[model samples]
Target: MERWKKRNWGWKFADHLSELYVVALLLGVAGASFAAALPLASRWYPPQYQGLAMGIAGAGNSGTVLTTLFANRIAQHYGDWHIVFGLALIPVLVTFILFSILAKDSLNQPAPQKFIHYMNVLKQRDAWLFCIFYSVTFGGFVGMSSYLTIFFNAQYGLDPVRAADFTTICVIAGSFFRPVGGWLADKFGGIRMLIMLYSVVAIMMALLSSLPSLTIATSLLFVAMMSLGMGNGSVFQLVPQRFQKEIGVVTGIVGAAGGLGGYFLPKILGNIKLATGSFTFGFLILSGIAILCMLLITIVQRQWRRTWIGASGKARAEHV
Candidate 1:
């Protein structure tokens, strides 16, 4: 009887959501796990350390690799991307087997309250700011991660090997620095961290705008990339603090914006490179965006001060 009931329940659960969540879960794990591990495995020496630069710039690029390698390979072998989906099902099958026995969601009930309060977050202007900030931060990380190597090859005249080497170095610096950026945001102030990081990015990008000698350009690029990566984490850290109760809405909107930013940033840079026979405009455009970010933060700073005052005024009046 127990076994029969279990089969019926499992069938219901699977029938409801089917494979969409499973595929997303697998893709997320595979992409993030590989990006984290790939840099750790590769060997880096001085000339070879250039790969590290490429890696740093393009660490998020592991997703493309996973898809191109596994998905494409499966497609070629079996004549469809659908085959890869089936291949992904194996892990889901195994997970289901384990979870069916070992794990269970608590059915505990909570007293109902005003569900309408959840909608209050929609009124917060900072939510829009957080979304924009994340768009630039995470967007820059993933965008540069995929394109940095190609950029180096185009801008610095490095061969494929050297381009990839620099990417590795750059991505390593950015990938790990992200979490640190968020920590600074938590301990210091998120807005303050954003101001500082955006300023750093602006200054560095300004210096980079000229597309100077390769040595200066490469060095400046590295610094700018580092700032962008940190900004990515800092923005996200602030997002949760500001939208604690509306996690799904905040995360979804911000994450989507970041993805869109990533999608377009490279194309913009690549187009600039293609049109002018150099990456000068690309550098200049990024620098300009950095400046815009700085300006936006300045505006937000005033709003933040007003908010603190209003909150404090309310508290004091209540005490009286």
Candidate 2:
């Protein structure tokens, strides 16, 4: 590290035009690694435990809390934000070693199929539905996580630190509820839970478009995050149920849909702000989409019940 600093290598890396390409490559690798966990989680846990298991695993998203809570402080303390990136390598390395040692494949792992066969999931209507559903839930959670600080600063006149504080509060609310969502879905029904959640999210977003007071906005956002978080759990709970055999491939595809959704949300907000000088349109647009998602799910309800739901109105503990 000292040698690189002495050689001015850090500046070289930071200034090089091609660094964006390198960063993008590395990000893709990281994304693949993260998505791999979903399929493994399906194999390790039975159908009934899918929600709780995935929720607990997904709670790793709370890593956002750590970054939000400390990134600025670390930069201030060290006088170089880049140094925190170096420090982060320590935890990443440690986690990799622990995962390699502790993680085990399930005995009943899905049999290997031809590589091209995984692509066949594209033929299924349910696959697209799940992808869109996840795109809304996980995508909205991530999008909000990315934009809340900006939103707070713009709407409430908060400084960056205070904005981050508020953002962290929302992030934590969402993260904490992820497992709770899954557990509730396990006890209740994932689809039913999601219908209720999406309806609430639509209502909240519509109300938020009115540009309420700071206190009211914060409360509304907190509830909104909680609902989205739980929606995420519910979506995954149904995925494994519907695509037990193709869980791995479906997870990768759906996860990518979620990423695309997250990418678009901030852009939509930015566009609305630019065109209309207010973010009200963005919230209204999201509210309309939420309503559309509810209707889509409702349309599929009868088919899902006949095909997947058991006599208990819940997913069977075993895959059909």
Candidate 3:
């Protein structure tokens, strides 16, 4: 009996390790796609349309909504989470085939920068600024997407299915608004739009810290997500305009920062909940960060307008 138990434990441990390895590979591919796609989007579109184009491509993150909505249900139906992973490959394969057949490089590809030129992007202040901005916007969007279902279940006593439903609603809002945010940024200014959106995020997150009624909390999350999504679009709108020559490297850096931020936000929330018996401090800390981002953008915009983006923060047509 003891020998049988030891063998069972070994099998379970091996299964867990295999799962971790596969998840790591999946994330690696996803990260590379994100980093590579933005640069292509920027190059394919003109400066004036950069925000809209990138926003549309970035909106692909809405795929998370489908997973959040269905993964648990699918797993439960099959009585196996592994089956869910297997099913996910269908869309991935379809996307790969479609992209291979349809995708095209820009006609006027920029000359490849040297390794030193790519490294020099890290020395630029603007690159770091973009990283921080995306850390809050894209970071918050992804972090919340991962955590909201758990939040709903713990705080509101919702069933797993219902919690996932609520999370799906919020993810949909964020995903849908991304393109709208870019279009608005193009018409107004990325800086101006981000300032307003960050302010909204601060306010909504602050309200969430109070642990309001379920309806109100979900509404606020939906609104906050919209702002975060738009903020993502707004940030990228400015990226290509400022670092046209180094978009690939800059996007990779900024995208990594966003991923790190996403990773940490959930850790912060989970740790805060464990320590405080609530997520209030976590929400408050996020709110404070949003406010800080708002102020930083405000202070920086004066100089940004004076330099690259001009008075409106719009990319000048001549730059294209």
Give the candidate number with the greatest lDDT. 3
How high is the CA lDDT of each candidate model?
Answer: 0.59, 0.84, 0.89
Off by over 4 Å in 2: 1-12, 15-21, 311-313, 317-320
Compared with the true structure, model 1 gives a TM-score of: 0.62
Order of models, best lDDT first: 3, 2, 1
Candidates sorted by TM-score, descending order? 3, 2, 1
In angstroms, the error of model 1 at 113 is: 11
- TM-score, candidate 2, is 0.92
TM-score of each: 0.62, 0.92, 0.93
lDDT of 3 at 215: 97
**Candidate 1 vs candidate 2: which has greater lDDT?**
2
User: Which runs of model 3 end up more than 4 angstroms from their true locations?
Assistant: 1-14, 17-22
Report how far off residue 286 is in candidate 2 (Å).
1.0
lDDT for 170 (candidate 2): 89
Which candidate has the top score in TM-score? 3
| Candidate 1: stretches off by over 4 Å | 1-124, 308-320
